[model samples]
Target: MPTAQATTTTNITSTAIDQKTVPTTKDGLPTILNHWDCRSSQHPTPVIMIHGTFSRQLSQIDVTQMLHDRGYCVFGIDAGHNDNLYTLIKPEYYGTAHVDETTDQVNAFIEKVKRKTGAKKVDLIGHSQGGLIIRNRITRYGGKDVRIAMMLAGTHQGTTLMGASKIVEEAMPHLFPIIAAPL
Candidate 1:
């Protein structure tokens, strides 16, 4: 039972557990469990951070912290989650979803953020496959709430797995399913 507390920041609602602070949406798994309400926040525009390959929202935790420290509202979600053998072994497995699926997740997270923060637009920041997923979300479905987008180690051009996918496609088409499950 973690208690919600705001630490050294304004308008940040986080759970204080083991001296660690984190925010999340209720009934957590894919969405965060932070119960923070930013309706009266100083910064009207919120920033959404997206993590990279085989990564979770924790990968962008530092960025979120930095943004909150600067009085900027920030939010993150576990995108690219998939149900497969990998997740059965490690429930924390993230960024394992296909590009199309991941984009859908991102899109949903954006809508949630908009509703929570009551902001008309949000900034997008992503790493690795997260960058590609952001592009897919914006391209496939119009980025209505996206104000600005920054991609780190963006794979918009392609992915390092392209060669691997090619090699596996030629070597063993049957095993492609194994390498193809994750980015």
Candidate 2:
């Protein structure tokens, strides 16, 4: 029998492993594009994944495998930046504002996925800013439909890296343009 861990939004259990596989996006990073809809379906809610700052959805290989083995569908958001402080402080597609935008996108995607999959709700797993983003979305934007949230090494408070960034943005307006290019 599997061991169960119950929470407000979902019930998680560790069951005997049947099969484990690596999922990937078009970019070749370990990614979750589909729910684990295998015959052994157990968990009803989908897993919405968020990666840490400068990290890609591909970074969640272990998590994806674990949830997949548990009969849960997993989805990952790339968050639009690489895992370098230089890249994070600089601008890419979403600029430094990617965190909030990514969170909102995650929420929207969750709702859409739920509607399509007929699942009642979703479970969120975030790492670092990935977690913070979810918290902000839930509290500020009213994520009542969210079933479960697990944050690993999450930043409940501000990060020193971000603080240093503020100083950089203030001290070097001229360099900010160059810095923002590779983000």
Candidate 3:
């Protein structure tokens, strides 16, 4: 014989935990490099990271963790999202937006990060397109809050695509600008 009893379940919400958010992209998706609450007291200066074209902030997790391990506060933003529906499928490719829009997003993210950590200035590290955006922000938009900026293999001369682009350039000189310029 089994006895059945009606039981009531109550849902309780706790306010003890604090919730915080940092903008990582135009779509506001959560990224692997955003650590709003992990601001290090020992390392007062905060470091911000931006990924290269056709990449996401998550690709910079290694850098973020390295900085964090060294007691530095690190945050990141994945700007420049393609307006096409493909973004919905592969959101990781977030650096396809127009240059103006991309730079604007980076500037806004930098301002937001400065406000969050209460840091007047921040160190910026960018790769490829990210670096271009940083340069544009600093030179064109007056990077008033940038303490230092570093660009990794982001030369305007163009990327070799790990040597593949060089091959393409030699094979088809006419298609160099057509195929490589976009990258």
Candidate 4:
């Protein structure tokens, strides 16, 4: 004689009570890495950490941990396909992907984070090429989801290295094509 309405009410109450028992770390933070409790009163906006070219999320553990300690929900993305060559080259030159490609990746990452966390906006922290990626996302792409952006050693304008890249491009136009080829 139990009605469908009675069954649905029981399911909803059980689910809500189960969520309250979810375990957290010693600091009362969620044990899941790169996850934030969007329902938290203190931190509504999550932080999206973008690694510069040729780097992966693993390289940003130190900074991530620091932010977590300060009670910020932190997330990161390994933009582009540079994981294979990460160990071989210098970190600076490691992220050699075209800006446009990285920007696209950043845009997707921001959207994904926003969806997952149920957050309206996110703060950005970019390092080196990571910085440019976020900038392109915000300016070129429709990145209204971003709340604040901070870049470390980020290049707003193209790097000159005292015009080294320019000189090389001029001297051997064909070489530029070969060097710029996708890995």
Candidate 5:
């Protein structure tokens, strides 16, 4: 079982995990777990890890654990399709969620982390589609709470699917136009 520490910030009490015992990589870094916390940490700012397309917070466990071991409070969330049914049945579709919706969720999570840690700003790390979500939140959704944003393998320009869709658009002319419009 994971070890947890209870912290009282304002009127709220949250359990943060003591990940010292969690498994680590060959380089000696803890593996991040969902909702794991280290609130007693002295670090002023927290770190948020966002998973890529079709993935949940667990996807970036290694990175999160690394940050925690480095003395930063880390958090993660399952944005877009967070429902259990959808996550279990068809996780890939989770990436299909609109950027606006995911960005809103990211913004909210950032606020919550800041309130809990009493930090002025938080750092963000995103992977794949998760990177795009962070970008949208910071650039479009007024996410001034973030101090630094790092993206890994993100779809910043667009997805490669767009190129394939263009080919189909030319081949089918009318049929593919409507089908590939979104891509």
Candidate 6:
């Protein structure tokens, strides 16, 4: 049986599995059956990796390689190469918020991955704010249809710096140049 390990942050609890005695998969990939079910015989489902602010898809290549070796497909999405949260949220002119745009991009990526792999669901892994986007999709947008979600160093709740910046942005729209410069 897989033991459960839970981590709590910002009033939300997420789980991990610890299965010390189980045999690994035929490919020797560690099995956490409680966390994810193997569909190795099925055509591989693409894994999506989301990177943090100013980071690129290339940053996740090593991780993608590992997943590929384990019999999974991998892909990454770039979040417009913005330096800070403020700029990403308020682009030159925007119809969607930063998070909304990023999530839309992810949703589109999922469709593309599904079409390419001929799989029903894709796994999602996100780093930093990328993880927040994953959570938003899962919890708010009903993305439980996704196979699995892994978040590394994600900021699920609004950060202190974000709160401060929102206040400043509301108070001084004219200083957006200065406020957004170092963001």
TM-scores vs. true structure, each candidate? 0.68, 0.65, 0.67, 0.63, 0.64, 0.57
lDDT of 3 by residue, 66-109 (tens): 56657887777668887555577776578878777988888888
TM-score of structure candidate 4 = 0.63
Q: TM-score winner between 1 and 6, please give it.
A: 1
The candidate with the higher lDDT, 1 or 4, is 1
lDDT of 5 by residue, 43-117 (tens): 656788887766666556656755666677777777776544445677544555667888888788888887766
Ranking by TM-score: 1, 3, 2, 5, 4, 6
| Number of the top-ranking candidate, with lDDT as the measure | 3
Cα RMSD of all models vs. native, in order, equals: 10.0, 7.6, 15.9, 15.9, 12.7, 11.5
**Models sorted by lDDT, best on top:** 3, 1, 5, 4, 2, 6
Would you list the clashing residue pairs of candidate 3? none
Off by over 4 Å in 3: 1-32, 84-89, 158-183
TM-score of 2: 0.65
Task: Give the per-residue lDDT of model 6 (tens digit) for 1-183.
Answer: 999999865542433333334354543233321123334665355577777654544445556545655676556555543445545664431112367777777777777666765677778888777788788777656875698899998877755454777788788989966876656
Tens digit per residue, CA lDDT, model 2, 1-183: 999997687666654423234555555546445643432257667788877765656556666777766677777656644345565464331213456676777677777767777777688898887788889779866867788888988887856566766687789978976775554
Q: Give per-residue CA lDDT, model 1, range 134-168, as digits (tens).
A: 88888987878788889988887766464767887
**What are the Cα lDDT values of the candidates?**
0.72, 0.67, 0.73, 0.68, 0.70, 0.61
Identify the runs in model 2 with alpha carbons over 4 angstroms from their true place.
1-23, 29-32, 36-40, 80-96, 162-183
Query: Model 3 scores what on Cα lDDT?
Result: 0.73
Best by TM-score: 1
- Clash number for each model: 7, 7, 0, 3, 1, 0
Weakest 10 consecutive residues of candidate 3 by summed lDDT: 14-23
Where does candidate 5 stray beyond 4 Å? Answer: 1-37, 40-42, 82-93, 161-183
